[model samples]
Target: MTSDLRLSRFEYGFAQFMSVMASAPAKLEEKPKERTHQTRDRSREPHSRSMPFRNEMGSEMVDIYVGPEEEPFRVHKQKLCRRIPYFDKMFNGQFKEASENVGRLPEDDPAAFDVLME
Candidate 1:
């Protein structure tokens, strides 16, 4: 039983990857492969109208464009801002998006934005 309880490193790694993939945002209807590949790493990249961020749960969290620490990055809220062409009408306000989620209100919602700051 104890032997069975342990998983090999490969198995562990595979499981971790699967979990990450499952959580990471994914496209619903497939698109041209080029576009799909380009936006894969949405978190740690520079700002672009093209970039989008979702968590390990296949939901849109934020549209991020990573930069430097001082000009560190630009994080955009979705509901107020425009959604990507393909992904529009998919998620509700602040749903299936960034890990930094908040209430179903506009980005300028004082309480919701406050939560995001923390």
Candidate 2:
């Protein structure tokens, strides 16, 4: 009788453990459902027209025309000044670039400028 009681207890405990293990996967599945709902909501949000480097409207205050006549990059002064110390000095200092609305980088490669801009 004592042996039967111990075996029954062990069986009950084993059944409970198995049930918990089975429910764990169900709980994991529920979590992904909630995440999918959140992802769908985020996807519905509007995206900005301007990218990290490119702005197409030509509305930026200043322009930097890089390279020779063959290739050029129209870059924003504020963006350049914010990123590079050399550009900040040239634009903020008492230089011709500061006076004029436009600046030129005749020697610099246009391809290199495109990479920097991106």
Best by lDDT: 2
TM-score: model 1 vs. ground truth: 0.21
Tens-digit lDDT track of model 1 for 1-118: 3457776554654454335334333332235355344536557756664434332123334443222222222233443234232123223333454334332322123322222222
lDDT tens digits by residue: candidate 2, 1-118: 3454444433554454334434554454443334343433446555663454355323456667766763645667777666655666667778887887667776555555555565
Deviation from native of the Cα of residue 99 in model 1, angstroms? 37
* Best candidate (score: TM-score): 2
Candidate 1, position 5, lDDT: 71
